[model samples]
Target: MMYKHFRHGDLLKQWAEQAEARIAPRIREIEKRVEFHQWRLLEAYRQTGVSEQHLSSSTGYGYDDMGREALEEIVARVFGAEAALLRPHITSGTHAIAACLFGVLRPGEELLYITGPPYDTLTQVIGEEQDGTGSLADYGIGYQAVDLTPEGKVDWPAVQKAIRPQTRCIAIQRSRGYSERASFSVEAIGEMVEKVRRLCPDAIVFVDNCYGEFVEDQEPSHVGADLIAGSLIKNPGGGLAKSGGYIVGRKKWVDRAASRLIAPGILAEGGATYGYLRDFYQGFFLAPHVVGEALKGALFASAVLEAAGFETTPRYDEPRTDLIQLIRLQDPKRLIAFCQGIQAASPVDARFLPEPSPMPGYEDPVIMAAGTFVQGASIELSADGPLRPPYLAYLQGGLTAAHVKIGVLTALDRMLTHSPSESAKLER
Candidate 1:
């Protein structure tokens, strides 16, 4: 409402008001959970006593680095894990996950994705495709997957059948990734852990925890996961961290991931912080509130778009465990227009229009609107989707609920008034 450059300002305002009213109660409940986690995180930091001395880097072996060790302790405490590894060298969520996979599995051992195939970037890592990339398959590891049922729930019988004697680990993606299915909840994940343990007593259960942190009172590790991994620039970074990722879980498993992250001999003893300590600490401190805002935005967007006849996953009133809001536009041109509109509402790149084009590690052309200080930061306002069938747009993150509301409203307006036919013509 502050900016009047977009069309249907009056209609958008009216919808926003109604959407706010509808979601107010849920937002209040979410605030309480946010407060609880914030207190827990603050207590963890307090117990660790993070100081300026601990913030500096230690090169070479990086042995006895107080800040590095303390940060790991704080992260472990927050996630209810025996140990944790938070590092700038860890890179993206994919890298963190790859470390865990490589650290735990060996040649001839299998990695089973019980929650179906993971995000596109992981297809190469899991050896689902050979793209000249070094993957688990390239190293002689094996892979398997069990798709979800039509109702979007885990196919438990199929899972039991799929687990093999050589299965070394069972990977469950907490978030839905790019799928239309709902993200797994902590309670559900806990049940899954029990079932898997009953079937495969010794199989390590690893949860790919990207986009699912700080949104709930309990984490996957708290619910009996052997290992969990996520990106710092996603839910936990609070829009301040430049780049990093974290892995937390059983001490032995985390140790293995650390070994893979650097080297078997060096492990967590190496890898300098490189001046990312202060931002990482502060970003984690502010994460709870930032996550609440993003969750509120997702709920609001779901409410508004579903009412407008678009198919949105996890309806506004439904329980949420992640920040993604998938809107099925069902039209390629509409999807393009929606992304462009979201970019226009961005604070950073408001003037630039997004177009579908080839991006690395993706099968189809993808269009993205990332108006973040840190490139590809999902914790900030951004919208992106693969340009293919189903024509869905994955909308995630907003530093504040107000920012999300404005951007989502602007996108809806553009979708309604903008000519998809004209956009389609341009596609030629």
Candidate 2:
């Protein structure tokens, strides 16, 4: 009956059913993790004593805004950090990360990326090409990177050699952004922190924590990271926060980052919530369960898509450190059709076709299918990728497993109809 409403073919329906049966055990594993994190978050809220008074908003200057302060404290406690900076002023994950980098490192200091080059958007922020648009390089800050080994693991020897006297900040990206490598787990990050501390004792260990929140039982902050940053729209927002970002870490580091967000002397004391406090608090409180739902959707998509004859990273049964599910479509047409199907199944903008277009921060033309209630919120069901070799499609987020099933089945149907060759491959 549901298939008839969505117009999915019988073959696709059968495939989905079989995939669901095969992944039932794995889904149960994710549910257990969800329960653990949900309890942890609930305890954080209780310990913080969140109440109706803390939900109120504040106006200009935002002096003594109890709600904002309490929400930040709750977030910091949940993430196992000494302090936190939660603000609508920090626009994106990239912005939050930039604030941390600029806040901690001085003009003469250097930033070393140990995991590899960060996400595409950060390339400009680091001024790798030096366009002089007020990047770190423009401000006299230097940058260096240690590439991951051929097998996609951290190159420890290279990392040791890369550290220098000027290296003030050591950055690790937990998510595999537009890359074929696996996302780093929190345990792996702990090992990295230990090694970094031994190699460069004074260097700041900063993690780009976007898309990786609530995926594990513990956060990077708990694993000896000096600082961590992420966007609210990605995972911690729980699909409700309109816009915001968070930075959590050592008290001094968080204070420095806060100074960058709101000028010094008034650091962390000025930004008004303007009625967004309730969303921020409630969104965070619900984040763990919401992340669990997204993880289930990701698993369902992986199992169904892989069964339909496509390559997927971190197969359905593999351990997950982030919500992203990378599907290798191998053809531009297949990629477009996949995105179109996802868009067509979207609760919003279902009739509009998504095309590959040049986005501001990315180098290649990127195609995205996001019909979320909040603009560009990845915590809702969406798929996107760059138009390049292998033509990998990156799928992430769903408020519910049912929605993800519909979207993925619709995508498979589109792909099967678009290419007879692919359909034959599926049949065989």
Candidate 3:
């Protein structure tokens, strides 16, 4: 019933077989990277002397909790940061980043972005596009940006010229958020940091490091990032963290972020770990292998999608720095159909149809097909994108490459088959 409906089902099978062989070497290389990161994580755990006692939770102010203290130390050491803030109180990656931004910046200061507009969700946080919700701009923090060059590289000259006396922070988004561009490498971020220091020696260099963790041997902090933030449910969570975020950087910045996360006087003292410490610790340990699995899945997805006559960013053979895999459907119906097929493959909510609708912190009506245990965890196999032009579907995360292969094949089958009635549903 499946292949009988798909005109190109045979082609999809042939392409997948070929891609598996072609990508074998790449998969081996990713496996090596995973092993290296695992060693690094083990060393951090050893350095911090994490013990079973460190897995217990503390309630009623959560002060003097040895596990909490050691967890923070391990995270900071692993990230090459002077200090770190790891708290379940910090709800989302966006919340963690906002805490750092508000903590270090004053009302009169300016925030400059060397990397065009940030992710869509952050636009609302920056108050660049008004959402009627209070944001950094509402508090008088000014925001400005310098778009990347046509080739997707940093516009260094513009960045240098844009630096002002009021410029208090320079925001660098490491991943290509909702855009078809190359994500910045850790080495590239270091170069950007050096240039910024040359122009404004005192301005803080902040990196939105979502989706970039464990994908490299070194982090933004290792390359001179003064402040960096990310969500635990992403790469670092290893698909296990139920909720939380992290901020790692200089002691002063982390301290300020702590103040913002809790109350000014409490400052990292009152937040409770609620017995999630063990999962968080275990997640960090497993993150390297899990992230490697996601990357291999993306590479394989790229190969199969391209062979199916659709365009893909960072073709399977291209270098990757993040988990996102963009596919260009170029039509709303096809986009919806692709998402529906992806949703169908989900282990949870497979029977539910995903519809395009407005979500908080985004401008467009976005369509998403995610059935992750962590609720929007991108580290699991998921796909989503805005229902706007280019009609791109940003597919990311797969706990295993075999699952990703199945999802891709399923989507291709649905795209090529499906009754006119089902097509009408997509058209709706």
Candidate 4:
């Protein structure tokens, strides 16, 4: 009966029903992960004695802020890390990752990415070529990347060959970002960490844990990563954190990253919470459940889109390590229309249509449909991608599965009505 309110056609409705039936087992699997993570986080909160007093805000110097310290302890306990830095001062995931990189590597040392080039925003941070900007390369730090094999697995042989005396950091990006490759599972990351340790025992194994948090039973820190960083606005924010980022790992590395975030002496000792502590603590507590909802939405999108003849990575039944559901629309118009539909379903700014435009830190024009409460929050339903070949649309995040279902089905309706060829293919 609720379906009657939407503009979906009879055929589209039938296809949706079939997709839901096919993905029911997978949905149950995601629920299991949610339950496990929820209990795990609850235990962390209890062990850390999270109380109302620990949710208060800090002022000015923020020195001896018990709430700030407690929250960091909770994050560290949940992630199985020696320490954690949770601060609003660190603006984004890229910033957190950059701090970790700058904190660990000296001027002569190098950072090697085993999972190929990182997300687009990081290209500048790594400074593939030394520009006048203060990128890692500008500071005399070296960077190298080993591409994944054709099968989308780590190039172990290439990784072995790429190691040098100055290689001080081995970085792994757990999510696929905008690429078509599969996201690395926690087990796979552990394997990479073990091999990297064998090749360079002292090398810091870092993971960019952006959209990959809470999707797995154990985090990369639980495996063998020496350091990991992510944006609070992504999975870990639980759609509640207004703004922030987190870095967790070995105490020494976390302390170094804190130093990079603030100053040497103020490492994890400064930065006022400014009334965001309640949101951060509550958001973290709700993250596991919220991430589970996003995962379900991703699965549903994969099933529906794949049935509609669009090529989708990590098919509905596949194991997921992140929230991204990539759809290759093969045409720019359809890509735009897809994002428009997602925006139309959004709770905020739905009246505005998204357009492709140049954004800083990216090489190509990008179209983003993020009508979220928090600016640029991917934990809420959003779709975005570059305006380039294959016209891929990367759909991520939904606070609720019903919202994703309506949004994606609406997108399918819009695309089918606009493209006769697409409708004809579905008809056949």
lDDT of 3 by residue, 1-428 (tens): 35444555666677788778878888988999999999999999998888889999888788887888898999999999999888887788899999999899988899999999888888777885334567888878899999999999989889888888999999999998888878988999999999899899999999999999988789999999999999998999899989899999999888898888887877766677888899989998999999999999998898887766779987888877788889988888878888888898899999999999999878889999997778988899999989899999999898888888878888877876665654344333
Candidate 2, after superposition: displacement of residue 363 in Å?
1.0
Which is superior by lDDT, 2 or 4?
4
lDDT of each: 0.88, 0.91, 0.87, 0.91
Model 2 alpha-carbon miss at residue 384, Å:
0.4
TM-score of 3: 0.94
State TM-scores per candidate: 0.95, 0.98, 0.94, 0.98
Q: Give candidate 1 misplaced runs (Cα > 4 Å).
A: 1-4, 59-61, 128-132, 420-428
Better of 1 and 3 by lDDT: 1
Clashes by residue pair, model 3: none
Question: What C-alpha RMSD separates each model from the true structure?
Answer: 3.1, 1.2, 3.3, 1.2
lDDT of 1 by residue, 217-319 (tens): 8999999999999999999889988999999999999989988899897878788787788888889899999999999899899887765667788888889
Output the number of the lDDT-best candidate: 4
Q: Candidate 2: which stretches are off by over 4 Å? A: 5-8, 129-131
Candidate 1: deviation at residue 209, Å?
0.3
Alpha-carbon error at 44 in model 2, in Å? 1.5
Residue 374's lDDT within candidate 2 is 86
Order candidates by lDDT, high to low: 4, 2, 1, 3
Tens digits of per-residue lDDT, candidate 4, 1-428, equal: 65565555777788788889989999889899889988888898898888999889989989999999998999999999999999998889999999999999889899999999999999888885567788999989999999999999999999999999999999999999888899999999999999999999989999999999999899999999999999999999899999999999999999999888999998999989998999999999999889999988898899988777878988998888999999998889999989998998889999999999999988889999998999999999999999999989999999999899989988888787788887788777
